[model samples]
Target: MRSLLVTGGAGFIGANFVRLWARERPADRITVLDALTYAGNRANLANVKAELVVGDIRDEALVDQLLASREVDTIVHFAAESHVDRSISGPDAFVETNVVGTHALLKAARRAWLGDGARRPHRFHHISTDEVYGTLGPEDPPFTETTPYAPNSPYSASKAASDHLVRAYHHTFGLETTTSNCSNNYGPFQFPEKLIPLFLLNALEGRPLPIYGDGMQVRDWLHVEDHCRGIMAVIDRGRPGETYNIGGGAELPNLVVIDTLCRAIDDAFAADPSLTRRFPDAPAARGLPTASLKTFVADRPGHDRRYAIDCSKARDELGYAPRHDFASGFAQTVAWYLANEPWWRAIRDGSYRAAA
Candidate 1:
C-alpha cells in the first residue's frame, strides 16, 4: 500500500478530505497528524479509518520519525492557524504554526526523503487560501495563480510566508512540491466560528446572528468536497513547483448568504415538526424567526472587503469541476448541522473548550 501523510487531518477541510480520500483509496495507508487545537477536533474524523497521530507539526522529532518509520511517500499539508479574527487577537500562534511549523515540516521532509538535494518520486502538497492575495475592490477581477502576494491580515500574512518557504524549498533543494490556494469552503464538519456555520448554529439557537460591517464582503464559496477533490487532483497530476487556484465560482456578498441561510433554516424547521420542539428556545419559538435574528456588528480590524478566485488553471489542467453550487451546498450543510446536534453542541457548551 502507498503510505500517505496528511497533516491537520482533523480540522474542517482537512477532516473532510481525509474521509473522502480514505473511502476513494481504501488500500492506501493513511497517517494523520494533528495538534488537536481549539479548531482541530478528532471527532470530525470519526468515520475515517486512517491511523491518527495527535501531535503538533512543529515537533521536528515526531515529524521526522513519522516520515522515516511510516515510509510516508506523499505529504498533504493542511495544518495552520486559520481564523482571521483569532489571528488578529493572537498573531504569535499564527506565525508559529503557519510559518515555523511549515519550515519544520519541510526540513524533516528534506532529511527523510532526500540525500544531497537529489530528486525523489515523493511529493509535498501545500494547501493554502486565496486571502494571501489581499483585498479586492468591487470591480476587480478574480485572483489568478500569478496574482502578487499582498496579504492583509496576520492570518493571510502567515500563509504567504509559508507559501514562500514551500517555493524556496522546491527551487533551492529540488523538492517536488505543488501548492494550491483555494477559495472559502463550506460544508459539514466546519467549526461554528466561520461565517456560514456561525450563522447557522446561532440561528438555530435563537441567538443574535452577527453580521460584520455592512455585510457586503464578497467571497467565493466552494463545497469542502469539491475543494478536497481539487486537492486530490493536484496530488495525482499537478506539475511540480506550480501553483493552482481552486474555486467553486459561487461568489456572493455576505448579506446574501445570510439571507439564504435564514430562508433555508425556516424551511427546514417548517418541514420537520420535531425540530421545532427539539430547539424550543429557537428564534422560531419567540416569533422573531431566523431572518429577524440578524444583527449587524462592527467590522473586524483589517477585514478584507472582497476575495474572488480564477480557477481556470485548475479546471484546464486537472479537469476539476465543482459538483455543488451554493444553493445545494448550503442546504446540505444546514441539514447536517440540524441532524448532528451533539457534534456542534459539544463545541458550544464549553466541553470541547475545556478539553482544548
Candidate 2:
C-alpha cells in the first residue's frame, strides 16, 4: 500500500482530492499536512479517514518528520495561496506560500528520498493552474502542455516559479515528479471569494452579485472531482518529469456561468417549495429573478481575458477525460450549496475561523 502525504488537504481542491483518493484507494494510507489557514478549513475534511497534520508546508523540518514518521512514498503538493485578487492586493503571502512553501516541500522530498545516493519508489505530484500561461486572445488556440510561460498576476507567477522548481528538482536530482496545470475548478467547499460561490451566496442573500468589468472573461470550468480523477490518472500512469494539462473541456465566459448559476438556483426553488423557507432571503423566494442581483463592478488588475486548456497530452498519455459536463456539474454544485448552508454560513459569519 502507498503512503501518501497530501499538502493543503483541508482546502477546497485538496480536500476533494483527499476524499476521492481515500474512497477509491481504500488500502492506501493517507496523511494530510495542512496549515488550516483562512481558506483551509478543518471542517472541509470533516469525516475523511486521514491523519490531519495542521502545519505549514514551509517548515522543511516538519515536512521531513512527516515523511519519516508516515513512511510516505508519495507527496501531492497542493498547498498554495490561490486567490488572484488577494494576490493583487497583497502579493507577499502568495510568494511566501506558493514559491517558498513549494521549494521547502521539494527540498524535504529530496532529502528524504534522494539523500546519500539512496533511492526509493516515490512520486511528487504538483498541482498548478493554467493561468501560468497568461491570457489568450479571443481567436487564439487553447494552451497546450508546450505553451511558453507568461504568467500575468502574482499568484500565477508564483505558481509558475513553483512549477519551474518542480521541473528543476526532477531534472537535477532525478526525482520522480510530474506536474498537472488545470483550468478553473468549482465545486463543494470553495470559499466565497471565488466567482461561482460568491455570486451564488450573494444571490441567495439578496445582495448585489458583483461582476468584474463586463464579465466577458472566459475560463474552462473543471469540476473539482474530475480534477481529482485527472490527478489520480497522472500519479498512476504518467512518466516522471512530464507536465500534463487537465481541462474540463467546457469553456464559457464568466457572465454565462453566473447566469447559469442563477437559473440553477431558481430551478431548485421551483422544484422544491421548502427551499423558499430555507433560504427566505433569496430572490427566488420572493418570486423574483436571481439575475436581478447582478451588478457590474470595476475589474481587478491583471484579470485574464480568457483561459482555455488543451489536455490532448493527458488524454493520449494517461487516457484521462473529464466526466462532469458544465450543466450537470453546475446543477450538482447548486444542490450542494443549497443543502450545505451551515458549512458556508460559518465561513461567511467568521465562525469557522473562530472555531479553528
Best by TM-score: 2
Cα lDDT tens digits, model 1, 44-89, are 8886889889899999999989998889999999999999999999
lDDT of 2 by residue, 95-161 (tens): 9999999999999999999998999999999999999999999999999999999999999999999
TM-score of each: 0.97, 0.99
Q: Rate residue 275 of model 2 by lDDT.
A: 87
Query: Where's the lowest-lDDT run of ten residues in candidate 2?
Result: 347-356
RMSD of each: 1.3, 0.8
lDDT of 2 at 25: 88
lDDT of 2 at 155: 96
Regions more than 4 Å wrong, model 1: 116-118, 353-356
